[model samples]
Structures are given as structure tokens and as C-alpha cells.
Target: MDKTEILNNICYTKLVYDRINKKLKSNYSKTEIETLLFAILKETHEQDFQKIGKNFYVSNVRNNIKITINSNTYRIITVDRLIKTKK
Candidate 1:
């Protein structure tokens, strides 16, 4: 799905919330996550999208975060912090 469509139709399941809570470093409320996602996604560039299997992964390098979303269902799978490591 396109960025706009994904934004407009973004959804979350009960299990998804559980997964998200365990995934993120900080504990964020459901409302907080939704807001954060909307803001980040609204500013997403074309290069942020990555398709793997049936999922769409949108990442923002500046924020050091990545979000996994189901393409067909528009459900947010999880959020991950992009940890940096020195060479």
C-alpha cells in the first residue's frame, strides 16, 4: 500500500499491542504509539519502505527506529530501535 493509504488505514490488534510493548525500550501507551507513528509516517520518504514477504518495513534512520506493518491488513506489527555499533 501507498504511504497515504497506510497512514489512513493504520490499525492494531490486541496481540500487536502486546508485541509492541515488549519491543520498545520505553513503555508507551497505545495512544502515544499511534501519535508517534502518524507523525513519523507523515514525513516518511520513498526510501523508507522495504517489502519482505507479506510485510512492509518502514524505517527512519534519523530516529533510529523501524516499524513493521502488515501490507494487506494495515496492522502495525512491531517497532524496533536501530542500535548503533562501532566498527
Candidate 2:
């Protein structure tokens, strides 16, 4: 699916919540995670959608983050922050 369709259909599942927390290594509540993620994605433009294999990687460059969603299910698989580098 495309970015708009995916975002519009974004869904949450109990198991996925655990995965997100583990991947992010944070203890954000479900509500907080959903709210924060949606806020970031809302600011993403069309160009932010990057499809590789079976998932779409929606990235927010300013936040240095990437959100992975299943192309078929539109369920969030995990959230990740880019590792900072020494400049």
C-alpha cells in the first residue's frame, strides 16, 4: 500500500506494543507512543515513504527516526532512532 493508505489504516496490536518498546528501548506508554509516532508521521511528506521488500519505512529525518510498517497489514512493526555519529 501507499503512504496515505498505510497511515490512514495505521493500527495497534498488543504484541506490537511490546516489540516497539523493545526496539525503542523506552518505556513510553501505549498512548504516548501512538501519539508521538502519529505526530511525527503527520509531518512526513510523500517522499518519506520508502518501500523495501515487504515493508514501508517511513522516516522523519529531522528526528532521525524510522518507523517500519507491514505493507499488507499496515501494522507498526517497530520504531527506531538512528544512532548518533561523531562528527
Please, what is the whole-model Cα lDDT of each candidate in the order they appear? 0.84, 0.84
Which candidate gets the maximum TM-score versus the true structure? 1
Model 2 TM-score, 2 decimals? 0.84
> Residue-wise lDDT of candidate 1 within 1-87, one digit each (tens)?
578888889999878766777877567888887898878877889578888899999988877788998988988988898778789
**Model 1: lowest-lDDT 10 consecutive positions:** 17-26
Candidate 2 residue-wise lDDT, 52-86, digit = tens: 99988888888788999888888888889877778
Q: Clashing residue pairs, candidate 2?
A: none
TM-score of each predicted structure versus truth = 0.87, 0.84
Please list the residue runs of candidate 1 whose C-alpha ends up more than 4 Å from where it truly belongs after superposition.
none
